[model samples]
Target: MAAVDQNSLRKLVEGQLLRLEGNAFQDCMDRLGLVLYPGDYQPVRAAGPKGDTKNDGYCPKARVFFAAHATRGETFAKTKGKIRGDLEGCLQEHRDVKVWRFLTNDTLPGEVDQFIDNTLRPLYPDVTIEVWGLKTLADEISKLKQGQVERIIDVITVDEPEFEVVVLNHMKTGRDLWPVLSNCLGWLPHEEPHDCTDDEQDLIDSAVQSFRDWSDISGDIEFSRFSVRDAQRSITAILEELAEKRLGLYAATTDDYPLTGGPSPFLGTVAIFRIVRVASE
Candidate 1:
């Protein structure tokens, strides 16, 4: 990728992070928590009345809790309120909370940042309080593997538009594919944040390679040497990982079928994820 494209992609990813609100932003933080804390990170969903059990999530191993409050153009007062409420909830509701990290989209002013360190720290002397804004989230994402980053971002923009979607879509879809493929592959949920081991990474890499290989097969080649089942499994692995209900790949035109003597029989799988923006949420 060119520097310009890389810059564009970074901005695109960061923009998405900053713009996400409600459950979408909380979901993003859950994904990030899984990456940053691995097996220890547990995403807490909002209960009917309890409301996330006083925290959005936590890592038992580290005794650290996380709370997400993502809103665009939010005032410092609102942010501070959320921080105080969530922090108090976590501290009062949970035991042995060594750290309470508030995740938000808006950047905190220097004074607000200092206030957490100073005023908040004194009130909650037993637990450390920290806030993570867009930059902090982006920095954490930078440390992830390309596969992991693609999953979080849902798409990777680059020079080659087709390859950009093809590779990254598979990565993004891998999370979606987890449920369907888990039984067959004996794999963990890719969509959920978890500690990915080396063997798990290898499984993911192999699935990606298989999809690429299947996609690259020449139509003129003899079918006898290839295991159609094996190829199907690979393709299935990739497609299953994609956003199913919100996204679909349909033939744009039947006129392009090989029987029609069309120049390009394949519309290209790149079309499958053009709407990832909708699917990702």
Candidate 2:
């Protein structure tokens, strides 16, 4: 076997680190439901306080700060020092801001971790710092992929707010598995019910049954795998049927409202469904 060239190894590591940082940044933003404005620069830059002056008036309302490094030892130290200096400057400029740091690298030295906890954290209490080595990013990516599965479910249930609501409610009711399911669903586990009543339970049950029936029908009519669009259509069809029967489950008024209007509850249900499917899978 031939030994790998040092230049080639460096290039490969750099490329991988760049890609991973981009992905990690995107994942963090998506998890927080943030609409990321385009950034012109890479997450990590070369070490120095020279360009630090440019950030004098650059107060960003970013909840998180991410830095990626491709090398270890002294190189890591120099890069971290520059980033810390820059961020500290930013924090000093903006008094009431909090920033979380995510550091991505193949390995982290013990002394560096200690420095982060003991030195940097104490100095900047407003900045919450988290370090992710290669293994951590790998694990996070796996979890994100699982979340994507439920996101597909959300897309399918878009048209069926009633069904989505019932599914979310059922997820809340199931004691043992509910927490795990709720994480997948992107909903915080609530100890108290969110205004679900006995009558609402009956409506929810019917809606869930309608979804299952539609899933069965979809399996027979088209492909084996159930698509979210099909799920949405099925939910919509069921809601329309219930409305025709004067069930009074949905609002009677057809007037357009804001995104946070009467129909917004149903929209939230769909959002929760997507979150659950992504997290669970």
Candidate 3:
């Protein structure tokens, strides 16, 4: 596969969350124990493409706001305080708040952290307030990378258990299966196959070849074969130590159907299962 550009990848991840819908942003805030009121939380800014701020309407329910200069310490601190104050006023109006969450790419200064912890939190015991920095958001994005693969597994493993195994095998082929996969395998040479030994190398090679063959088939068909092929290749590589034993896998059934006029109809239902073995005498 083509090499991933780290800068581009970072932007891709950020793009997913640059301007979330107010409700979605509120949901995230709630999950992180951020405070919110029980009313319409609208955008304070104008309702056009981003950066078009000509309309001067008062956003009565502005749940999420992007601070412009988080890197500037003093300015960021003042802005955080101002935003926090606005949120506190909103809470006062509604009174039915669960939590208030702040999402940003920069860290809070020590004084600001202490102020929030010791002053604000105590004053509003009922409303929980939490902050998530860029590092935390990045970690969540990393998990999402794995989640995309798992979702494919879930879709493919809907009905038939045996077919799920096949789908899992397919998931192992996609490059960058996980953000950390490269980090884990970085020590090994790319040209050298994993495990080095004859039997292990054979199994790895077989998995890789299976993945390649299924690639085109996956595009033509609706089954989660492509995802499974990528996932399977990754799993196989990771579990090389257990090469001697037959691995068991499983997935749940799904209601989704494949699109028409693509390549081929998905052939069967897929389910997931795991294998447990007794010690041999």
**TM-score on alpha carbons, each prediction:** 0.53, 0.32, 0.35
Error (Å) of candidate 2 at residue 263 is 45
Best by TM-score, which number? 1
Where in model 1 is the C-alpha error above 4 Å? 1-9, 156-159, 162-281
Candidate order, TM-score descending: 1, 3, 2
Summarize candidate 3's per-residue lDDT along 1-281 as a digit string, tens digits: 11222332233233333333344443343322221223543323335463323211122354332222233234746755754665565465444556455555455577767877888888879766666665455345434443342221121223322212223222222342222222111111113323356765575456434433433234224356566556546555644433344422121222222211123323222122222222333
C-alpha lDDT (0 to 100) for residue 77 of candidate 2: 71
Scored by CA lDDT, what does every candidate get? 0.56, 0.38, 0.38
Instruction: Tell me the number of clashing residue pairs for each predicted model.
Output: 3, 13, 34
Identify the runs in model 2 with alpha carbons over 4 angstroms from their true place.
1-62, 72-76, 93-95, 146-281
Report the error of model 3 at residue 186, Å: 11
Question: Alpha carbon lDDT of residue 13, candidate 2?
Answer: 28
Task: Write model 1 residue lDDT over 185-234, tens digit each, in one string.
Answer: 01111231145456544554554445334433322232543554454455
* Better-scoring candidate (lDDT), 1 or 2: 1
Runs in model 3 lying further than 4 Å from the true structure: 1-76, 145-189, 193-195, 198-281
